[model samples]
Every structure is written in C-alpha cells, then in structure tokens.
Target: MAPTRQMSRPEESTLDLGEFTLKYRGDALPQPELLVIGKRSGRHKAVHTFVNILDNDGNLVRQAAITPDIASFIFGSFEVRGSTEAFNIYESDLVVGKWSPRTRTNVSPDLVRHQRTIAEQSFTATGGKLAHHWPIFQKLKETGFGSIIRATLTLHQLCSSNCPFCSTILRNKRDSVSLTEAQAFVSTLYNEQAALNRNEFVRYNEEYRRLTGTDIRLKGLILSGGGQPNLWPHFSEFVRWLGELDLDVGLITNGFPPKIAEDVYERFKWVRLSITPESASPFYPDGRFDRQYIPASLRHNDSLTVGLSYVYGPWTDDDMLKRLDASAHENGFRYVRLLTDCNLTRQAQLKAHQDLADRLFRLGFIDEVGKPLSRIFHQLKYHGSQREAEELWSDGQCKLQSYNVFWDTTGHEENGYSHCYPCDSVTVLADEQGETDISVSERRFNADKWGTVKSTEVHRLFTEPLQPFFDPRDICASCLFMNNNRAVSDLVKRASYGDMNLDTSLEHLNFP
Candidate 1:
C-alpha cells in the first residue's frame, strides 16, 4: 500500500497554553465554532493529526462524541480555526486531544484548588524541601537506607519458569534473605526513628497519616525478588512475620504451587501474577500443573485483589489480547497490566506493541478504570510528551537522582545491605567470593555501601545532603523512571506555583 502524502503548506496554532502544536490545511475557520484536532501521520513517518469540529453556530448544535475511528486517524487536512478553549477528550491519557474552539471556557476554581492542594501535600509529605535544598543530591537524600516507604523482601532466588524477558535470568547466583534477616530489617525500620529529629519525625508521621490514613512507620511490605517468592523455603513464616507487624502485604509471583493458594489468599492484601503465553499455555500435553494452577488457585479468593501482568512485544496482537482477556475473566482477575519490554534491543518491538496496546485500549478491550492500568498508560503518555518538551525546556538537571530506594540480597552472611542508586539505572555486581555487591564504579562514587536495617541512614538520607557520588546528567539522561518521576515532580511544582507555562523547567524552585 502507498503511504499518505503530506501537505505542502499547513497553517498552525498552539493549544493548551502551547502544550500541543496544531496544524491544519487551507484557510482558517471562524470563531465560536468547535474544532476537533485528531492525530495523523506527518512527513518522515511522524505522528500528526487533522482538525475538524461540530459547528454549534450552524446546523450541528450538539457536542459530537469522539470515537476510536476518529481518534486513530494518522493525519488529514482541515481549515485552521479561531483561538478558543480546547476540551481534552481522552480516556486514561492514551487518547490525547488537541485544542478545540469552544464557545465558553470551563473553569472550576474548586477543582483547581483541590488539585493544587493534593500536589502540595504530596510534595511536602515526600520530602519536597529536600529536593530544593540540594537539587543535585535530592534523589539520594529522599531514598536513604531505611527511608523507603515500601520495602521489598527477597524471600529466595528461584523460579520454575524460564521466561525470555525476565530480568532475573541475568543474575548468575541464587540466594535469599533468611527469616531472621527479614525480621531484623522490618523491626529496625519500625523502631528506628533516630535518623529524623523528634519534631521532623512527628511532622512527617502526621503528614503520612493525613495522606494514607495510617500511622504506621512504613507503608507496606512487598514480597518480591528476582525469583518466585512462593518458591522460598520459608514463605509461610515470612508472610506470618510480616502480618505480625500489622502492615499490609503484597505478593508478586508466577502463580505456581497451588498448595499455597489459601495461605496467599488469606495473608496477602493484593497479589500480582506475572502471566505470559508460555507459562499459561493451554497445550499442556505433559499435564503440567502450571497451566491450570493460577485459575484454580484464585477461583475462590474473591476478596484478595488479583492483577495480571503481561509484557507485550512484537508477538502480541488482537488475538493474544482476546486470549488474555478471556483468561482474566475466567480466573477472576480484577485487573490487567500490559507493559513494554525495557531492554534497549527491543525498542522497535516495544513500539509495535505500544501502538497495538493503545489501539486495544481505545477499542475498550482492556479495562480503562482499573487501578495501575490506566495510571500506567497516563504516565506513559505524559512522560513521552515531557521528554519531547525537555529538549527545549530542560536545564540538564536529574529529577530522579535519589528519589526511590531498592534493596537486594548482598549474599553477605553478616549483613544485608541496601543499594542506594537511581531506580532507573541499577547495576549490581558480585565480588570474588560471589557475594552480591554494588558495581565497583558505583562503590567508588560512594553510591553503593553497607546499610544495616537499624542504621539511621534513612533519616539522614532524607534530611541531609550526601556527598555526590556520580554526575546526575550522565546517569539519569536516558532513564525512563527518572524521567517519569521528574515529570510528576515538575507537574506538582508547576501546579503549586500556578504557572501557566508548565513546559519550562522548575529545578531551581525550593518549594518553601
């Protein structure tokens, strides 16, 4: 098939306070007429759109509903229109709308105030001032050793399935944190308030309570690791100990070993099953239990929220989506999360799958209102636009240098240390003795070190600026997680400041 042709000359206008660039062919339209700008394919295979609208001033007096067919258009010709308010018609940010001419502007002061209040509250609660105080070392300060809200317990490093896309397959060693170590880690975080001053601790705790309606020191415990968490030898004991802490527990697993279904259903508040075609194959000629185990296990656990996670690539298509949806419906899975492969080699494949995923979302095959699914889609779109804007607006600062914390088994018998690095680009190594350690380069920069569970490192990391271990620009340049986090932080900063030009960088703002 022949490709679509581009316009020789196109009229253009800026929308959403210049967040989106809109171009149309032919003459400009008159004012008070609604203009709909939909996406289209531009020259050099770029994604562009066409503009048209329902004319309430003339014969068509009703608001036209945007369907998937209108939204999926690559590009088309239209006459430019007058300056007016653009109504964003979208579902979970997947379908973005350019500015449309409107008769009257829809402004809600209460909604604006509410949004700003939420942004300010989140910024303040999550150590907002720390980012401004030492912008370079902000991420490091926020994610100090024990300061992390969600703690992931690596029960053991062992899995039955050999999924090709699994990051765990890269690790050469297998090990798990002992029950004693896990207990110590949780206990330390629970009792250790030495890092923060009394007043600061009180304020943080109060803010957390107000935000989450919980007075617990930590948010929740996540039972996850490079391997299958349920395959650990002491899975039940670990779950019981975490329950004793009086905190919610979450599990991420391949949904194997149907024996532990009751325990998991009773103990875990939420569980995510990493489902893939190979793992959930229907052609179980060998009568392997993996195929039937997940559905059978989850059939009775209606109270426990079950989410299905799938990594989409070039192989994913409409048929696969239908199969996935059918499986979710049959297994009583309440939510489905389709994710793109992060490996750079699969970028093209990822893009293919992303386009397909967007189409599937627009077609209503996937649940739009489900938690994490819609949220992740919005984040994907927002980050994409944010990255494009960064080319023109960024000041070469890293927004996620020290934002979140991650801990893995160091294979050290004496101590299990938490590696403090940007969550986006993590590189761990093993010493001559095969014990897990941070890479040598990271160690040289003091980015990797031994952090005891009881250490006051968490408090100090949040309140005080640590010595710079690495350049933020070099490390965080291509990190998607850092970019997304920074984008969110920037949004909060912009909203709180009431800045109309959100495209500009706000790294210098201290949020006093």
Candidate 2:
C-alpha cells in the first residue's frame, strides 16, 4: 500500500463554513477577479430576469439583469438561492432589463445553444463526434431538469489487471478478497447500481425510446470496478452493450493492453491513460511494474481525446521525458496529456530526488516530478470532493473533468485532498468554431460497476448532496484507502497516498 498523505497542518481550508472549509491556496492574492454582466428582460413580456453576482471571495455578490423576450440572470453569477440551486432565479427582488431581440437564424441549434451557454450539447457537427451521433440532425430534443430523470440499463465493467501500477496489488490472495467475498460484494454493488441507473443515469437507446415519452437519455455509465477493469471476465460483453448505446459512453481504466485500448478507442471518443512507468526497480514485478513503456502509434492525429496521467515516486526516472517526447511527436495524441508522480521511498531514496527534479525542470521535464502534477491534471478532469489521490490522479486521479462525473463504490467520507474539477459535466464548453459539449453525471458511490444498482439509498447516506444516490458493496478495497506505506515486492503502492513514514510497522497498514 502507498503512504497515506495527510492534509497539511490539520487545518481545514481557511474558510470553514462549518466542518467543511475552503483551504486558501496560501496565495498572496487571495481574491478572484469579479466580472459583471447585464441581462435583457424587457417590459411587456412575462419573462422575469434574476439578479446575482460573485465577488473576489466565493460569496455571491448581488446584481440584477432583465430583458425582453428572454429573461435570465447574468452568467457565472447568481449561484446562491433558496428552494434549490437550479431554480430560485427570480422568486423575489428580481431585476429586469430591455434590449433588442436577436436571433442567429443561419446557425445550427447546437451553435445557438452554445451562444446561450446551455449546459451541454455534444451532438453538433464539425467540432465533436460525427454529427450523425446523438438525437441530433432532424430535431434535437431537450430534456427539462426534473426531480427524477434518467434510466440506465446497468452492466458490470472490469479492470484488466489484478495488480495495477497505481492501485494496491494486495498482500496476496489471503490479502485480497476471496471469490465468495467478491460475490457478496457484487450483490451489494448491484442493488445500488439499479437505483442510480434508474435515477440520473438515463438511457436514450432504442429500448430507452420504448421506455419513456421524454427524450432525457442516459447521461453517464461506468466500465470499471473495485479492481482492474481488464481482469473483469464480462468486459467484452459490456463493451458490446456500450456500442449499442450509439450515444456517448464513458470508460475509466488503466491503459494496460492495446486490445481494450483499441476497442475503446474505436468506439468511444475519450479515455484516461493512467500509468507511465518510470525507473526500473527490482521491488516491482521484476521491473515489469516499474520499467519504461512505449505506447503504440501516439501520432495518429485522430479525433480521439485522451487524458495522460503520470505518478511520481522517490524512484521516478527519465521515463517521463521519453513519454513526453513521444506525446509531443507529430503523430502524438490530441490530449490534455497529463503527467504527475510520487516518490514513496524513505529519506535515503529522496536524497537524489530534488536534484533530478531540478534537472527535469531545466529540461521542461518538471511535469514528471511529484503529486502537484497529478493534482493539476486530475483537477482538469473530475469534480469529486475527495479527488487528488496522491498529489494527483495520475490518470485514476486523472479523471475526466469534461463530460464526466464521479462515482464511488464505497459510501465513504469525501477524501480531504486538494484537487480541482474542471469538467463540462455541469457547464458547457464551446470552442472558437462554436462547437459545444456538455455532460450531466451523478456522484455515485460503490456503484461504479455495471450489472445492477445495488443500494440506491447509499447515495443519500454519505452526507453528500450528490444526485441519484445509492447503496454500497459489502467488501471494500484497500486500494480505496490507498494509505499504504509498508509496500513489499510487486506491490507498487501509488504515490497519490503520501509520504510513507518508514518508521511504521506493516501491521499499521490497517489491512486484514
């Protein structure tokens, strides 16, 4: 297991609303620049425009905007209210404005939505998947926000390996869950999966069309488990199910084999590449877990979007530079190509670490240095409260901020790690060309598996306001703890945890 990193100073964020607080970046500039915009809620119209604003502090600053025909609040403002977040726009003290009504009759609906700043619309042509995708083209439909929306025909997805580079490999079979234990775990997992799948994880496939009158399609699905995905026996079947969706399907897996890689690549447009081997070490599976890697044809220049994850350890070496060289190559992937690492060695191992960091920094190779790298990259992908596994989500920590959501199989407390979630899940993104994309997801726990939604109520219990909450699995994974420091052979504990106090005993790992 890797060392469990602790929150610096045991001081919650400087701005403590309660037990929950916002840790200042400790930046000299502790304020955010404020932006103000005017709205158009003209007279003689029934439309009611809302007033709100945000200041240097995260608190909502007050303002008003009203216009004719279209009535709404200023964008990026008006985040706080009563009833609920989505509505509460104008119930009281609302402001109004009047301006010329404009229309882009020549532009497409998706582009028009982009201009309106709607949450998500990836079915557009040119900038995204082929225009033929989604309920696009003929007449794109919109599903209004609802109390209960979505229905996922759930399935179980798997990790390909038992011992992945970033996860806990186990103390052995005895150290890991037995077949009976795993089955029980699955039972609990399914119960929760069902509830969540029905709630927010809607499906709009052929079967889905038969299931409902509204066009609110399935939003998010998982192809991973408590263990490595590839190792899951029913993986191929799950892939086939995803293909049947004919809509956007998502997957989170350690890039181990080219088989799953190729299949997912050919089918889905996005993926997360978690592991990038650094130094060669005997402690690993005879360097098999620690040596270097050479991914096949990174220079494709295809439409595929990839997130690169790099974890650093006290042992990280020159492998990062090599990967960077390949990634930046002509045929390399169009990626938010991320790299971050951790050094899990004792003081002795770190002796040469700083020197190497300096050298790499000089060579523009500082990315392969430590937790900070993964933290930044992961922040770019996920919005989970407990994100930032090591100092980063080297790819697992490297979640999809854009078009994604977080789902935990275990109903645990939010990991008090510092990481950012910059995804389009709740918002929308439009490039210079007016191509836009959006994603809506649930922060499910212990329901990452597919087969069935085990305990839907588990979502409500963890004391989190995540939507479509569900139950949890019986057996849990130590890797989820990821606070291991007494790692032995082939047990490549990830750096995301933290400094392994070499002084601790194996029994202190809190493992069975």
Candidate 3:
C-alpha cells in the first residue's frame, strides 16, 4: 500500500463506491478522526465513522475494495508467533478481537452492532469500581496452573483469644511458619523462583500481550490466619521484611498486639481489625475503646484505610451495638463492617444479618438514608431467601479457587509449616468443630488437607494442580465465594466462543 494524493485543504478526500462513498479527513495526532461514509442515494444522511488508518501519518495509503486482504491491511497489525497476522476492529467504542490471518474474514455489520450491545452490557456487569473482576478471564484461560492474583498468608497458628465461634481453632494445634520460612516463601513468589511450564507461560504471555501491550504483574498478599495474625511472635519483623517486596500487602489482625514500628505499620495498603468482645476483652479489659487499635500516627496516614470487622450472631444485641459504635468513634477508625456468624445455618445467617442491619438503622448506627452514618459501613447486603443461597452453591465447581488461595501453617508434623487450602473460608470449615451440617462424615474437618508446601513446592499449588484430600462438592456446604465462582464460570463460558477480549490489564483486578 502507498500514500494517495494529498488534499488541497481540510485534509479530506472521498472514494466513491457504487453503494457508498468513503470520505477520509484529518492529520494523525487527533482522536476520532472522522471518516464520512455516505450512501449513494441523496435521500439518507451521511454516516460518520472514526477510522485510525494503518500508518501513523494518518494518510489513506491506498484506494482498494473491501476485500479480506484489504480488511486485514486496514486493521492494525499485531503479530502472534504461530499465527500469520492479527487485526483489531474499533467499532461503537468497543475494541473487539485479535483476529489471526486464517480468521481475517470480514465481520458483518449486524454482528459488529450486536457485539457493541454485548460489550456495553458486560462493562455494566463488570467495571464497577473494585467489584470489576475482569481478571477472571486470564484466570479462566490459564485453567489450573495459572497466575495467582491474591493470596492469604497465615503468619502463625497462635492466638491470644479463644473466641466462642473460632472455626480454625482445631488447626491451631500445629506449629506456625517461622520467620525464616515465611521470608523464603514470599521471596520465591516475588522472584518467580519456580519455573513455569513452557506452554503455560506462552499462553498466558499471549493473552497479556493482547490486552496490555506490555507486561503487568500484580499479586495481593493478605497477612491473616487460622489463629490471630497479630499474635505471631515475629509479626513486626515479617511485616517489615514484606515492605521490601513488590506485593500489595493487606492486614487482617485482632488489633491487640506487640506494637509494630510506625514505618512498618504504614506499609500495609489496608488494615482490618477484627473486633469482637471475646477477642478484645483479653487484651483491652475495659472494652473496644480501651486502647487505640490502630496507631495514632497512622490515623492521618493518606495511604492507609483502617476498617473494623464485627461478627453479629445469636448473642448480639442493642448493648453490643452501643459498645461497637462508641468504640469506632473513640478510635480513629473509618469503617465498621458487620458480618454474619458463619456457624449459624444459611437461613439463620441471612436473618441474623438482616435483623442486625435493621437494628443498626433503628439504633442510629446506620443513617436513615441506608448508608453508614459517620462510622458504620453499609455491610454486604444479602438478598433473597435460603433457597436462593442453596441454588448458588450448586452452580458449578469453585473456579475462584484457581485465582486466589489460602496459605496456612497446618501441615504434616514431620514437614515444616505447609498447608494450601482452597481459601480461608474452607480452612475455617475444615477446622470447624465436629460434623458440619454440610457433610455427613464427622471427620470432614480433617478431610480437606493439601500436603506440606515444601514437598511439592508452595508456588506450584497455584500454578500446578496437586491432588486434594477432599472434594469441595462433598464437604463444603456453605460457600462464601459462590458468587465469585459463578461469575468466573460465566466469563469462561463466554470467552470460549471468542466474542470479546476481556478488556483487562495484566494487573487489573488482581485481588480476585
């Protein structure tokens, strides 16, 4: 293809086809460079389209018919190794497909319009602040051995409190991950020490290349546990060491602890303090407001957002709400999240939260506007009845397990601290007190164990699938990740038909 004749003024030219005329205008620097394509009949209006041509100089390189070869050339060039060529079509504000040479056939106008509608709906469903979970596309594409977006690292198995509803209490009998082992595990992930399969790397690399023209690496690490994470003897040191790595670290702690260094404390992106009477009474005898849960220094820390987590259940009442409200105000806490006690039945859990929310509003803890007043957070709303919750559980396999993982300190006594559970929710259930309603076996608590991390490589648990001791379908009755799992499964099914590009960056929405 070669540059056509230069226009006299306005940088516009027209090529008259029998049915329509292709009018091109403008220099390369501007956006939405107008290309007016008019119908041959004088009755209809000229349809304006935005066209970014092959060359950077914005020149209409050649006057050619709309053939397969011309369509391929007109589309931007993106080289795929095994494929001959790739082209991108920008229509109705939706960028669709990376067509290979073999599939460079012209897309019908009707199909393009339909894609725009679907794309808009998808964007509406996704791309809604932090809830936008486009990372599932990459997660689904890679299947079992793919990228690990976010992880929960249980620093230790020791706790300062014995809460009545402690689910992982049984797992706490085992030893915790020592400072040395914790450092090694984190370093390995950050440095990519474990070799990925050649084919796996190529497949992941191609998808990344298509979406983000460059590499994007993001993995969120939450320092939480089977026991209190803050109770870990080396908590301060481990947190300090974590600052040196490239991971985005979040903390889930029971605010009472050996004070962390001012600088190290600020390294966390967000800090969630789980404040319960049972957990708080041991450290702060007076109450939740006995001491500042988050340090005063971090109160105004621009980078930090501290939140309080309170579980509402059978024992919860108006007095507890008053105490929680007073405590949140006393401390410099910004948000107070109310959660349902997982120990209750699904129906009971839903009713408990609804009742709590209603009580919270009536007590002025939450505003009349159905939002947090100045302290409380608008908790995660649970709509629908018990039957709806049950149906969601039966959707399919837990696909979100491939994206995020739970790493705790329980493993074989002979081996070091190494146990990779599906997620924190599962770990809690597997360790919950005798015979859960979900499973018939009384020993279901001990059924879902993955072998020691050291023997099969800790990182491989994410990239490589190892045999699991328990099937989630059989044992897991209540699923916290049911919605996420369903969303991912739907996206996987959609992407299989090759309709959309997932519109996600390598680092986009990695917390899933």
Highest TM-score among the candidates is held by which one? 3
Q: Supply candidate 1's per-residue lDDT for 268.
A: 72
Better of 2 and 3 by lDDT: 3
lDDT of 1 by residue, 284-389 (tens): 3343323456544466467666766676543344565666666667667665565544332112222324354455666565343321232122112111223433
In candidate 3, position 224 carries an lDDT of: 80
The lDDT of each candidate is 0.39, 0.27, 0.47
lDDT head-to-head 1 vs 3, winner: 3
Between candidates 1 and 3, name the one with more favorable TM-score: 3
Off by over 4 Å in 2: 1-214, 256-264, 276-301, 327-331, 336-361, 365-512
411-468 per-residue lDDT for model 3 (tens digits): 5343654666566665333111211222211111242343224422657655555333
| Candidate 1 Cα RMSD (Å) | 17.7
The CA-based lDDT of model 1 is what? 0.39
Over 1-512, each residue of candidate 2 has an lDDT whose tens digit, in order, gives: 22122245322112222111122222122211111111111100011122223222212334333221112222211222111121112222233421111221122112110120010112110112211112211111223211111111112222233221222211111112223333333333234433443464345223233432333323334444333454444455555645664344444455545444544445554444444332212122433432323244333536554444444322234555455444534335433233221111111112123333443445553354322221122111111112223333332321111112233223221321111121111111101111011111111121233112222322222122222221111111112212211111012233321332232221101001
Question: TM-score of every model?
Answer: 0.54, 0.34, 0.62
**Which one is best on lDDT?**
3
